[model samples]
Target chain A: MEALLEFLSFQDPSVRMVTLGAVILTASSALVGSFTFLKKKALIGDAVAHAVLPGVCLAFLLSGEKNPLLLIIGAFITGWLSLNIIDFVTNESKIKEDTAIALVLSVFFGFGILLLTFIQHGDYAEQSGLDHFLFGQAASLVGEDLIIFLSVGLLLIALILLFFKELTLISFDRQFAQTSGLPVKWLELLLTSMTVLAVVIGIQAVGVVLMAAMLITPPAAARYWTDYLPRMVLLAAIFGAFSGFSGALISYVSPAMPTGPWIVMVATTIALLSILFAPARGIIFKMKRQQENQLKILTENILKSFYHLGQKHQDMKHRYSFDEIHSIRPSIPKPRLKKGLRVLEKEGFLRKKENSYRLSAEGTEKGKRVVKLHRLWEVYLTEYLYLDPDHVHDSAETMEHVITPELEKKLEEMLNYPDRDPHDEEIPYT
Target chain B: MKKKILQADNPVTEVHDLTVTYDRKPVLWDIDLTLPKGSVIGVMGPNGAGKSTLIKAMMGLLPLASGYVKMFDEKLDDVREQVSYVPQRGTVDWDFPALVKDVVLMGRYSKIGLFKRPRQSDKEIAMDCLRKVNMEAFAERQISQLSGGQQQRVFLARALAQHADLYFMDEPFVGVDMATEKAIVDLLQEMSAKGKTVVVVHHDLQTARQYFDWIVLLNTRLVASGPTKEVLTDELLAETYGGKLTLLNEVSQEIKNKEFPNREE
Candidate 1:
């Protein structure tokens, strides 16, 4: 805890720079990644990240120094080239986009590794610790390294603010954007450059190998939280910045922990948690909705069965024992049937006295609607769709719980307010 | 407004020698046509016959092999604001993070231009368009929660918000319900009455006579193009359908099922 406080409190000047650098790089990348993820071009971000390596090494080889500005320029060149190459290859041949991305990513990254190795072996001065770019040495960042992030982050945020609507429209509906005369080709170039810029600066903290996760994972988590793009971008930036902060702090506490891989790990955990526990779109929420729907169907089925028994005995207020209800609905097991009976009773749909249950007034009306919808569907199907009455009963049985009041009315009007269904059975009415 | 007849000058859109291909397979071939002003035109064709490609080509979406499209007898770049496009609903990822109003607000972005925020007046216009489509109640609702019919209506609202003189709709009626289809048809007729030329890529021959003032028939080639009453004869339809009545029947059945394939590709 002391180490964490010390790391977060920025007692060490280097710790402050690393944390700030990591946060800015990641947050900007997350903003750009939201658009890429939405465009379903997520893997393109991965390719661009890997493609930046040769540029960084070539920048060092040409300049003979590790100038952050020069390295960024070099990285931008090769990164921009990589995106164009992918586009050219996909357009010129039958090679699919995924295939082209994989091809370009491997070749560019392979060339970068070769260049990096050459730089390490060359007689260049001040080349110590250059291999840190491979896995990201966030702990090694100083005031100069922070410049790469600050400049790029400002440019990214500024462009995102200025071109948010154009960027969004083109990403969501390119054909419409083109027809609307938004200078679509120029917008695509702008977006591609932004993607390249985001990847170039982000690689310093997240590293080449794990930089793609820095771009994609945060947005994936943010999507589960909201259906608004601006809010999603904000959430993704927070998630990305948090991962970056945690990764930098962990390495600050324990020097052996590599910050890049750790950042990827933390981001992946957030995405998994968001997938499982977030509200509305999350897995747990969807499962809960499914369970609620099943319970509704079960309770409605029990009420419908009770209503049928009342009709058979010519008494609406008759009380029935569990065995009698069970006898009518032999499909339901005893425990489940009893549980449903209690649930209906608790819902004020049934009156319970010594385990014998009778339908309440509201429950009677609810039960009648279900039965009415079923019979109304039956009459419509046989009368309109010409389905056999026997076959129609099974369909109407399912549609009973699904139909709304409006649909029930439409069915009645379409069937001409029929009292008797095709089966010659009395269609129950309220 | 009276029904429109195509003339040589002052056409809403004129395509000459336009061809499009995918994987070297020709989707459209030598398609030369002129659409009239203030008319509801229906482009009818079979699957893979480039009904969508035709509109896309005119909108400058597809790279034409050897042709040009003139809007209002002028270059497309000059008259872009006067034109609007509604792509097939299925072409979009409906799960996009946006509300109904946000999507409609995009219609005004062309006018608002680059690097500027939409004003309150723009919001009012978007809301008015939403109300026209009977979707004002859903302005705040996220788009993913809507049904296919509602989504189609939302797309219509977005197009209407553009306030363009020429509109191109790619299969707008495909997945919509009967009532929604009627509403859209009414909206199109109203637009035509107000002197907007609308082109729709349609598949239902049953409603072709009732819905359109002009028809452009195709089967990978220009089979016919003229007024609906003159061009929708059994012979021209047979030629456009190319003796594949069985498949046409199956496709028409699919339309009735509200599940037609919106695009050839």
Candidate 2:
């Protein structure tokens, strides 16, 4: 906690440099990674990240020291090479792209490990800290590394903001963009280059093994929150920056922890939370929506059964017994039917008198609307779709619960305000 | 190469000796076609009959193996701004994060050009196009919330926002509801009435006769291309869709085998 406070205060120069560098690195990666996630190329980021490892090790061995410029150039070249190889393998042979990605990822990562082991065993002072590149050592980030990361990261974010529309157009619909006279191929190349650069810049803080996680997880988690591209990009950048600061703070508190794994852990947690709890698209919300629909359908069916009985008896306020309602829909379990009735009574939509149930004024209005929509939809199917009157009832049963009030109004207008359905039933409406 | 001099002054689209190859197999064989201004033309064919390939080739989305396409008596690149395309709905990711209005605004992107953002006038034009398709209420909704027919209408609205002189649509009526189908047909007639050239890749043969004024029946080779009353004969439909085009199929297979000797399909 003291170390975190110290880091935030910027009193310690080294801690400030590491924190700032982590933020810049992750923000840029998330910016470029949004498009990669949209492009459905999540594994491509993995391949490129792993592929840049051997290039970093080679740069270390050739320069005999940690030269950030040489390492970035080396990483970019190898990353670009691996991307082409994946494309080439997919285009040439019968091998699919996923298999090709797996192949290149393993091969390049294996080569990087081999080079890393060689550098670790050498009798040199500078080679001692080279192993830090495998699992990132953000605690070791210096002033020089911060400068390189900041400049390149700003360049990446700038390019993305400038060509945001073109990238989004290409990502969503490539064929449409091409037909619209946009230079799609060059734009694609530029996007891929930005992705490669992001992976390269991110490797220092998150390292080769966990870089793809930072690239893919933020955008994927952000997707659950928005349906706008610009907002999604901004949210992903914020999420990435949050993960970076948390990872850096944890590493600073404990000298034994690595920044890469902690960063991935934070991102994974965010993604899991997004999947479980986001509104409209999340698993919890989807299940909740399904349950609500089932309850709605049940309530509507009971009300509709009441309407049928009332119509048969020629009495709008007629009461019906449990046995009679059960006979109306035999498929609903007994307990579920009781539960539906209890819920309706609780909501003041129905009134219980001894063993029979009758609709309240609110319940009657709601039930009439349901019946009106169902019968109207039935008439529409029969009149326009030419369906037999017998076949339209089963479809209208499902549509009655799902159709919104707006669609029901449209249906009424389209049917020219008909009062009777094809089966000669009255569409009750006030 | 016999050039048809008739209607040379105002031909909307002209294709000469066009052939498209996919994996060394000819999809659209040597085709010569010309369309006049202000007509709803149907490019009718069966599945795998290069109906989509022909539309894509004209828009320069697909690489042509041979020949060229001329629009407004000029090369396609010279007048690309005047052309708009609505590709197959199945080709795009419906789950992509974009609002209906943002998608319609993309139709104005070509006019908006690079770097600069879309202005207020552009937004107004996009909304106007949405109103034409009766989707103004859904302008702010995510595209995935739309029904299949509504999605098709949204694509039509995007194309309408382009305000182009020539429009190429691939399978605009497939999987759409009855109301959307009627709406699209009415929009096509309205556009044609205003002197716009619209070409649709139609699948249903029964409606093709009534929906379009001119039809281009294609099955690898051009079976017929003329006015609907003149070219939509029972015999031409048989050649275009039935097994009567087996010879053309065999010839295409032979060409594939000869040109790509070592390649496998």
Candidate 3:
């Protein structure tokens, strides 16, 4: 706890520079990455990340020192070139974008690794921190390097804000943007430049190999939580900054763990949690909704069977044995049938006498509504769709529990309040 | 290539020798046609007959191998606000995070310009367009929640929000319900009545005559372009459908077969 507090305090310049550098690198790339993710170009971000290694090595060799500005310029050039090569190859040949990405990343990255080997073997005095670019050394982020990353990060964020709508329109519908005279070519060039610039700055903190995680994970995690673009962008920025903070802080306190992999790990953990727990779109919530729907259908089907028996025997209050109900609803498995009965009884929808069950007054009304919906849908299918009476039952069987009261009213009016269904059975009254 | 190519003296849209190529192969051959102002025109062709390629080329969405398109006697870049396009419904991802209203509001962005967010009045216009398509109640719903017919209706509403002098629609009625078809046709008629021209790339033969005032029939090349009565003739339709015209030709052939009783049956 004391180490964490000490690391967080601005009294230490190295710790402050490291944390802010990680934060800006992540937040800016996440902002740009949201659009790339939306455009379904997540793979392109990965390719660009890998392809920038040659640019960094070339920048180091030419400058003969670790100059942040020269490195960014060189990295930006090769990163931008990588995307153009992918486009050029895909357009000119039968090679698709994926294959093009693979080929370019391998050639560029292989060349970078070769150059890195030569530099390591050679007697270079200023090559002490050069190898840190491979795995990333956030704890070693200097003040001058932090300023360069900050300036570029702010530039990226400003450009995104200035052209948010235009970028959105183009990403969502490029042809529409063209038809509207939005200068799609210029906008595309601008976006491509922004993407390259973002990747260039982000590669310093997360390194080339793991730079894509900063770009892809935050936005992907944010998408699960919101359906609005601005909100999604904001949430992605927050998630990215938080992961950057955690990664920097962990490495700062421990001094042994690499910052790049830790950032990726934290971002991935957030993505997994978002996928499982976010409302409406989350896996767990979706499964919960499905289970609830299945249970409701099961319980309603059981009640519907009871309603059928009472109408047949003219004994609304008579309790039927579990065996008797099973004979009618044999489609429901034995275990599920018992569970459904228990749910209905516990919910006050069924009056239970030992192992047998009958509908309560409220349960009887609800059962009547479900039956009415089934018969009404049947009448609609047969009368309007020209379907045979038998063909209508299967469709109505599923739709009975799905229809809402407002839709039921509309169906009633559209079908003109049919008295009897195609089955020659009277539809239950309201 | 025919003298029947409907060239209006004062055309709303004019295409001169427009050729579109896909992967260096010409998909839409040299096509010269003109659209009259305040008319609902239909371009009908069999599948892969370059029906969509023609409109996309004219709108400058595709690279023109040759030729140019002019609207109101001005280049497309000069009069963009006076023109609008609705691409095929399935052209974009329906699962994209947006409300029905947000998409409709995109149509107003041409006037909204760059860097400026949509204002309250722009939103009101989008709402009004949604109301015109009978989708005002669904303005708040996510686009992915819409059915095929409802999505088509929303596309129509987006185009309506443009309020352009000329409109281009690709396969607007395909895969839609009878009510949606009726609603879109009625909306088209209403637009024409208000002195706005609509050019639809249509494929259905049964409803072509009723849906459009002018018809352009194509089969990789222009077969006919004139009034609906003249363009939809039996010979022209047979030429447009080509030898693979299965559904219409089979029905007509069956009618003749039934009359003659010449089959083995």
For DockQ, the strongest prediction is 2
Quote model 3's TM-score: 0.92
Please give the lDDT score at residue B32 for candidate 2.
84
Model 2 has how many clashing residue pairs? 0
Which sections of candidate 3 miss by over 4 Å?
Answer: A8-13, A320-335, A353-357, A385-393, B1-3, B243-265
Cα error of candidate 1 at position B114, Å: 0.9
Q: Taking the candidates in order, what DockQ does each have?
A: 0.73, 0.77, 0.62
Per-residue lDDT of candidate 1, residues B82-134 (tens digit): 99999999988889999999999999999998889999999999999999999
DockQ sort, best first:
2, 1, 3
List residue ranges in candidate 2 displaced over 4 A.
Answer: A1-10, A297-346, A350-360, A364-430, B1-9, B243-251, B254-265
Q: Residue by residue across B1-265, what tens digits does model 3's lDDT show?
A: 2325656655888888886666554566678898788899999989988999999888888888778998998998899998899999999998888889999999999889998999999999999999999999999999999999999999888888888999999999989999999999999999999999999999989989899999998866777888898788887887778555456445545645455322224
Which residue pairs come into collision in candidate 2?
none
Point out the higher-scoring one by DockQ: 1 or 2.
2
Off by over 4 Å in 1: A405-418, B1-10, B21-29, B243-265
* iRMSD in angstroms, per model: 0.6, 0.7, 0.8
lDDT of 3 by residue, A287-356 (tens): 9999999998999898898898899989877799999999998888999999999999999999988777
Tens-place lDDT digits, model 1, residues A52-163: 9999999999899989899899999999999999999998777999999999999999999999889878898878767777777677667776875688887997888889
Docking class of predicted structure 2: medium
